[model samples]
Target chain A: MAQRAVKQERAVRTREALVQAAAEVFGELGFAGASVSKIADRAGLTLGAMYFHFKSKEELAREIVVTQPARVRPEHESEGLQHAIDITLTWAYGLAEDTVLYAGARLVMEQEQFNAPEENSHRQWTDIIACDLRAAQAGREVRRAVDVEAVARLVVNACTGAQMHSSIESGRADLPQRIEEMWRVVLPSVAVPSAVARLEFGQSRGRRV
Target chain B: MAQRAVKQERAVRTREALVQAAAEVFGELGFAGASVSKIADRAGLTLGAMYFHFKSKEELAREIVVTQPARVRPEHESEGLQHAIDITLTWAYGLAEDTVLYAGARLVMEQEQFNAPEENSHRQWTDIIACDLRAAQAGREVRRAVDVEAVARLVVNACTGAQMHSSIESGRADLPQRIEEMWRVVLPSVAVPSAVARLEFGQSRGRRV
Candidate 1:
């Protein structure tokens, strides 16, 4: 039983290494330009070992898409608009520094080549934000005139653009700042006056949240 | 002189065809994926003719980036916030249908591979919008608290993301609507109350501008 457990742990580690290497290659070369051999080499694993885990490049790319967001967990419990803000700010900061997240974003943007499912990270974020906004509306934190769905869509879309712009222009060094600026412009229109006053847009808050 | 004029017109036609074809190829294949021979074939021109106009593929991509924005001209003169809105809306609408502009946007996004200069379309838009916001500030169309440069960067970055999201999800069918929604969220924060009331977010207004 001890030997079996150790073998399983080793398998997990190898799989993780492959995923990390695949992400780096995919992020740099994109889907059409990336190759399995290159990914395996980058991971420092044999091609046979890579195939033992992921069957193809598309599967590797899909794994990155489905799994990257799960890595962003709120550090502390929050409610309503604060929760929504925490998610956005945390994601902005994560996207700037995390290799897997950055590559996942790039893959999601260029997923057209792979003929992947239409439901992607953007939709997931919209749903998540909309749920939070609904809670905020119930709490009277958000303005009554604001449409939860529309605001959620706008936030997700704007963040997507801001992150991409930062990635290209400044290597994502300014993503958090860009996202904060975006919220300053958007929060006034969506949140009630009191909620706007209470909400925090600081980088430290992102880490704590 | 008449014969010379006819020859010049034919040369111009050939150049336009080449640009259009290059845009289509580059938009679909990106910079590294695109080939000069394929571009020439798509243009329905001989390799010799393509070479005469553009010495290399990099030159062709550069031309697309430099020339695409010049096509987005407003129908009539407008100033301040109205002009800013017009440019954003018109660009959103144009991006959905125009082939060259779409290609240009893609090229600008994937320009890292080519080692191109950082001053691409997004920066250009930011500068243009900043100039307009300065005019708007002078005219009292914008609020006093709003930072013209920061807001301009936010607007451009948000639009970039919105257009890219629309392109990936709906083939850019919903870009104009997305831009309108973005303006709804942003305008309230940046524009004076009186200016907000007069701003048009309609699709028809985009065409007029």
Candidate 2:
């Protein structure tokens, strides 16, 4: 029993290291330019070990793209529209420096290169935001006439564009500010007046969350 | 002189054919995946001819990205807010079928692969839209308090995101509709109420333009 536990812990460490290494490689070289051997070398592991952890480069890319939402966990107590805003803010803040997050973002855009049919990070994010908007509508924080799916899609797409421009303009240093601006213009259209007045767009809100 | 004119016409045809072939190859297999030889073959032209027109794939891709704004020429007499809307609507409509337009859009996103520093297609679109917004503000079609740059950036970014999602979800068939939804939510915040009432989002508006 003790031997099995030790082996399992070692496997976990190897998997984490491989993921981090793959993120750096993908971030630097993009999906097509990155090689599995290069990723294994960067991770200080052998080709056999990398194969043991990830079956192929496509699988690793898919894993990174799908795991993007999991990185932006809102630990704060906000819910509904505020919660949705905080989630995006948190994501924008993390995107400035997080290797895994930014690499996943790049992969999500270049995913067609790898020919993975099941990869839909944008849809996943839209659904997550739609859920929050639905909750907000139920609580009356959002307007009755607001289209939840459309607004959710807007949030996802706008954020994607904002980050793309931000990456080019400032290396993502001003991403949080861009997200704030997006919310400022969009909230008035979808949220109740009181909710709009009370919502926060601060970097600190994202950080604290 | 007639012989020289014939030579010039042949040169122009060669350049146009090369550009069209490059767009198709880039559209099919992204930048890194595309090759100069394949492009030359697709165009049914010699390698020497392609080099005479475009020195490299990066140069070709830059031309495509920089000329994206030129593709959305607003031929209509709508001089202010309406002109800006028509430009985007026209672009979204074109993205569905225009190989050059969609390929340019893709290259703009994946441009980091080619190492060109001067590619700022988003900035170009933002500036173009900002120009129209300034004109609209002067005409009292837009609100005095509206930040022209910010709104322009939003329009560019939201359209980028909207087309990306539309491409993924529906192969861009619904991109014009997505752009309309974007304007529907954003116009109330920037345009005067009267202008909002008058502005059109129909496919015919794009077609007419």
Candidate 3:
């Protein structure tokens, strides 16, 4: 049991190192330009070690694209829909804790490498968000007539644009706050008034924290 | 006098030719990779002539960044806000414009180029859109108290995302219609109810028409 625990911890460490190194390489060289060898070199691991952790570079790229630990966790099903969005964005922000990740996200998003299943797995985010919308509507947390698919697409697009702007902006003071403000304006359209009140503390937009 | 007029027109033609060439080069090579000699070559102009018309490559980039002559004509102003949006989107679709512009716009928005007037000039598009939003609101075409700036930014982002998606999706039959539908939802927010009813007389989201 101890041996297995040690192995698991080592695997986590190696996986994290690979993710950090890959973010740097992908950010600098871009998705098309980055190579597995370069990422392996940056990670201070052999190519074989990388393959041990990930089946291929595409698998690594997809993990980076989704950037959400919750998706990998078994307990996501227990979290409420809004909580899930909040968790995913927080995870995305956490992945961006490495400064290189901020740039990597931009490069990957711009290049938009979609052929690989790992990279394309980012689509799961939209579907997840859409499912959340459906759940919200079913629970009377959202409006009945709201088109969940469109809302999901728009939410993804808006958050993407907002995140890109946050990273690229020169004097961004509290970008997360700014992004949350965007959510405030958009949420009321689909949200239960009670949820909005709870999130807003009963204050109007531009007034709430 | 006629000889001078002929010279001026010739100069104008050469200037326009260079702009088109610069845009093409920028499109193909991206801003960081594009150079003046290549642009001049594409324009079928001597390098010296290109230099004579534009002082430097950066100047040409700035010009291209701000120049949307197809959408920025005086007629755009006369059409009023809703019609201006229609004309602008029509021009985007008409040119079969590339989504590469979003990358260009992203670069322009970086604001990392310091406080140079030329660099700041790229913000003209944002300002122009904001102006349109204000006009739209003042005309009672949109809801009051809405954050026009945020919505304007969202509109720009949504359009960019759609353009990029359409480029990748080979059977782009309904992509243009999707864009139009996006506008339908957006424009109604700004126009008065009666006007919204008058303006919106099509399928809300026509499939790839």
Best by DockQ: 1
TM-score leader: 2
Per-residue lDDT of candidate 3, residues B1-209 (tens digit): 99999999999999988887877877666665678899899999999999999988777776755555333333322333555465445534543543334324434433343225433532444466677778767887667877877766666555544544444443334445655655554553455667566553233211112
Question: What is the TM-score of candidate 1?
Answer: 0.92
Total backbone collisions for each predicted model: 2, 0, 9
Candidate 2: tens digits of C-alpha lDDT, residues A134-208: 999999998998889888888888999988888887888888888888888788778889988888778766863
Please state the interface RMSD for every predicted structure, separated by commas: 1.8, 1.9, 4.3
lDDT of 2 at A178: 87
* Docking category of candidate 1: medium
Model 2 misses residue A177 by how many Å? Answer: 1.3
lDDT of 1 by residue, A1-209 (tens): 99999999999999999989998999888887799999999999889999999999988988888786686766767888888888888877787667788888788667766644376677778898999999999999988888888888888877887777787788788888887887788888888898889887777656633
Superposition error at A4 for model 2 (Å): 2.4
Top-lDDT candidate index? 2
Chain A superposition TM-score per model:
0.92, 0.96, 0.71
Instruction: Order candidates by lDDT, high to low.
Output: 2, 1, 3
Q: Per-model C-alpha lDDT, please?
A: 0.82, 0.85, 0.58
In DockQ, how does model 1 score against the reference complex? 0.62
